[model samples]
Target: MKSKGFGKKALDLLFPPRCQGCGKLIDRDDGLCGACLAKYGDEQRESCPVCGRTARECSCGAAALGSSFIGNRRYCAMTFYNEYNADSERITEKLIFRLKRKNSSSLTDFFAREAAAEIMRLMQLSEERPEEWIITWPPRTPRAVLEYGYDQSEAVARRISYYTGIPWKKMLVRTGGREQKGLGAEEREANVSTLALLRRKEADRKRFILFDDVITTGATVREAADLLYGAGAEAVFPVCIAKTLLKEKTDDEGVFV
Candidate 1:
């Protein structure tokens, strides 16, 4: 029998691995090359989206999140993202696009690790135990799931569960809807009818951490939280790999919905 290492070496020679961000050949098939990896997490938050203060100094309360549907709970994200920026300038956007186009365990795991740390920090500050919270995600549209053969958010949630030791459950379902990629804020808000509760009774007074790949207009999460609240969830704290930043809005203007 051939050694697995030998087989891998042969495969690499046959099909060179290219960086997902820049198409540069890399030593391994790890989604991104050294340069792209170094560039990751380098984008400064600049200021807290909830408050106008510098990110490192801001101490806004949960109610400042500006989402009445979440019971004034806080949301966490690893980085800020802007869909309008060219992927060349925003490697995170490229990673997100790649993840949506195809599932990559390494990529998803990377995102989950960061998100897990942030979630833990928030829970610790709030004196909430991990076991008290359930990990869940706003399921992707059925059409996207069928096209990609997986829900990227679900993949991230499962990995986060593994990192944080929190149990993950499928609590929401998306029947069918047009993809929200290019839709405007109002269009996205009006598109919430597609989502429905999957485990309605299971949500009773349960504290949930909703995970997702990226948060754009916040429409999807708002709708998801609404469903959970209606299902009797005690609270829903959303966590994501990236949060969309509105460049036109100043820090004092509140970037999130």
Candidate 2:
């Protein structure tokens, strides 16, 4: 059998490491090149710390707000993309789409590290830390998984677990449902309402931080939080890599305009 070191060298030779953001060849697999890394340095400044919306337009409603979820739950996100601005939003969307659809390993690692940092910040800001905090995710439907050949949320969750030293579990299972994409706001909520169930005996009064790739309408994560809360979780925190913000437009007789 080939030695482990030799095998690693051979693999590296066959497929060189590339930067996650720009796909440029890099020395390591874990980070973006300096230029790509610089792009995300101001992400927090571009997003609302409270609502995870872009600074220019962030009127988050009660349901859409992360703190309004059940069971003393709160939501937080890493970056916000304003949909009306195609130039900026496309940059965010490209990263997310590559991660979800292409299963980009470097992007996954990058997001996982970012998420771990956010969790750490939350822990520091919390009034009292929980006895134990577990990592979990709202699973994708089996059909979607089969079609995509991977689960994006699960991938990120495992990486977050690795980075934070918190245990990760597949606590929720999707009970087959239509895809949430292209659905209206209410339809999106209804589509995902009964889609996920807590795995048997997995939620035993533990605190959970549910991870996802993005938060558009907040319906999917809300449903997942409801399941965790129902399964006796003491608290549920929803975390995402990106938050989508709706653009504001005035009507013909808009007084504010």
- Across 78-177, the per-residue lDDT of candidate 1 in tens digits comes to 6667673445477887788887886766677767877888777776766778998899998887757757899899998998999999999999987756
Point out where model 2 deviates above 4 Å: 7-9, 47-73, 82-90, 127-131, 178-194, 246-257
lDDT: worst 10-residue window of model 1: 63-72
TM-score of decoy 2: 0.76
- Per-residue lDDT tens digits for candidate 2, residues 1-257, read 37766675577688888876677898877767877676766654575544455532333433444443323335666667544332343445557777777787778888899888777766766543533788888887775786899999999999999988888988888774576667799876676424566574678677888898877767777778877777777777778887765444333221111
lDDT of 2: 0.69
- Candidate 1's C-alpha runs over 4 A off are 1-20, 23-34, 44-73, 84-86, 178-193, 248-257
How many backbone clashes does every candidate have? Answer: 0, 0
Q: What is the lDDT of residue 223 in candidate 1?
A: 81
Q: Model 1 misses residue 35 by how many Å?
A: 2.8
